[model samples]
Target chain A: MEQWRFIDFGLVDIRDMMAMDEAILKGDGDNTFFFWTPKKSIILGFFQKAEVELDLSKCKDYTITRRISGGGIAFSDDRCRQINYGVVGTIDNDLFPLDIIESYKQVCGVLIDTLVHYGLNAAFRPINDVTVDNKKISGNAQTRWEGKLLQNGTLLLDFDIEEMLRIANIPKEKFLDKKIASIREGLTWLDRELGEQRDMEEVRNVMKKKFEERFHVRLKTGTLSSNEKELTKNFLPKYYSPEWVYR
Target chain B: MEILKTKPGIHKARGGLIRSFVFVENGILKDITISGDFFLFPEEAIFKILENLKGTPVKREELLKNIEDTYAKEKIQSPGTAPSDFTESIMKALEA
Candidate 1:
């Protein structure tokens, strides 16, 4: 049986995290965990073409990067976002895709428990999204490699909807006064919903506790190994290059 | 000619983002237009790349390779902008 681990990093780059995942896939380290990113960033899906999904002119003024997993594009920043990543070994191949979906359920259960603890109505939505009162609060994506599964998700602690709308180039008709109001009606924030602002550390602690309780495993704190550092150095440039980032 | 216009699912930013229109004629890629708010260095360079890519087949791997090679020659680092970005955007449009 493999042991689970928990790591909390304050602010890190999406590129570094991608590199670490690549190293883990290559069998360079044990299963690990960490979360850190600046206030504003957009991570594109692995197979996504960057030009079509992002306003590159707008992104030039912000931090944007490509991720290793496949999914839709997502925006995250300091005030409204926290990243939680988990890597586990000892996966059962016989389960295949079911294991992948079940993993989401297990992790989302922790989030639901934490939200319930905080007195918020939260539940797991199918195919990888967590919602509160039928509005999305978090979106998750996953990638598997060599008997290991790396699942990570973004929790919306606080987000700037206007900024999100601005950076992503939302359709302008939606910007009309009443239309914008209608759009806002469909979105919710944790700070607003909970009636209090929650800091990153507080959220991290709660999620860590809930994850341990739900998975029935102990989590240890650890850092990326030397091999991981080497892998990242080589991998970062490739990931950052147009070859991988665009195509 | 079969022309299809669609949003590239890969790039997630909202406004003035690039949209791809793929033109296939006789089962071959006749042309593709990647238009939006992205900036390309030496703006005309994008048109030049597209002009050259006009007659290529609509296959995914070939399109990716040609786009990659063309951008490498231009010394353009990020393709998420104009021409190169347009190429990637078109590929994603085709996939979707």
Candidate 2:
């Protein structure tokens, strides 16, 4: 069987996490499956305007930045135990299909499998969301650079709805078709779904296993290569700059 | 005849919600800013569409055709949002 590198980058600053994603996509590295938790922050979709998506007055303490992928806004915090995972590899491989929607389905399928293993009825909602009973538990997005594809996602172990509402300016139009009246009514987390918090390491293990099974590859624990580290270092300033974040 | 005004419009298409802020002056599109949670391949295509709409007459059919033309030229692939969705939001902004 083929082997893919797997790295668990425990906890990283949100900006550094964004930088690393771009670095891995741009650098020549082995196909990688990485896990990490980001420090408190609100990550904007590539196309989103921060001023329109965020209530800046309430986000003074958060690290705000825009990711390379196009999706909705995402809020992550290590304290809340939000877990993140990414799969990065060259487009030449069959692991990720060339069609955007098809690839999203394939990547999000892994999350659905992992959730099913936990006895939850998780389903892949088109575009890029994993939902349990129609409530979103995870959101994912992807970006392609040259020949490489980087798809990253967040799995909410627990969500602070009040905190999220305070910082995010989720427009009411987004919920027009859905029965969702508020963010709380439209979201579910592992902790709330299971009635308890699952061990973080245990959850990561399941993710690693599901990814391997779905893609038919072995995940070998590994770390970032020298090239990836250097690229990440070079890319840090862009994430830290207000020009990119507010753009 | 510089009567500049900006208005916000929001619409939920089959694929996702598209929100737009349209700036108009003297019944002509001055500029437009489109942002949303929807996924658009070659994310920069939105800007191209905005540029194409500038100076367009503030009419539903014209706005719709310009947006459609940009999508065709750019080969825009927004899974959940269609050109009509964008036109709807932009038209809504103008009407507002």
Clashes of each: 16, 1
lDDT score for residue A70 of model 2: 87
Q: DockQ (Cα-based) per candidate? A: 0.06, 0.56
| lDDT of candidate 1 over B1-96, digit per residue (tens) | 222234332332222245566766775778666544333333345556666677778766667667767777875423224333455556666676
List TM-scores of chain B, every candidate: 0.64, 0.87
lDDT to native, each model: 0.62, 0.84
Candidate 1 residue runs with Cα over 4 Å from true position: A78-81, A93-97, A170-183, B1-21, B27-96
Q: After superposition, how far is residue A237 of candidate 1 from its true place, in Å?
A: 0.9
Task: Give the alpha carbon lDDT tens digit for every residue of A57-159 in model 1.
Answer: 7777555667666555667755646555555444654322335556667767777887887898898865566878867677676666556666667777777
Q: Per-residue lDDT of A1-247 in model 2, one digit per residue for the tens? A: 9999988887788899889888888888978988888888888998888877787988999989998888888897546588798889777546788887788888888889999999999998887889999999999988887877889999999888888888887778787577777767889999999999899889988988899999899999887889999999999999999999987
Top candidate on DockQ is: 2
- Categorize the docking of model 2: medium
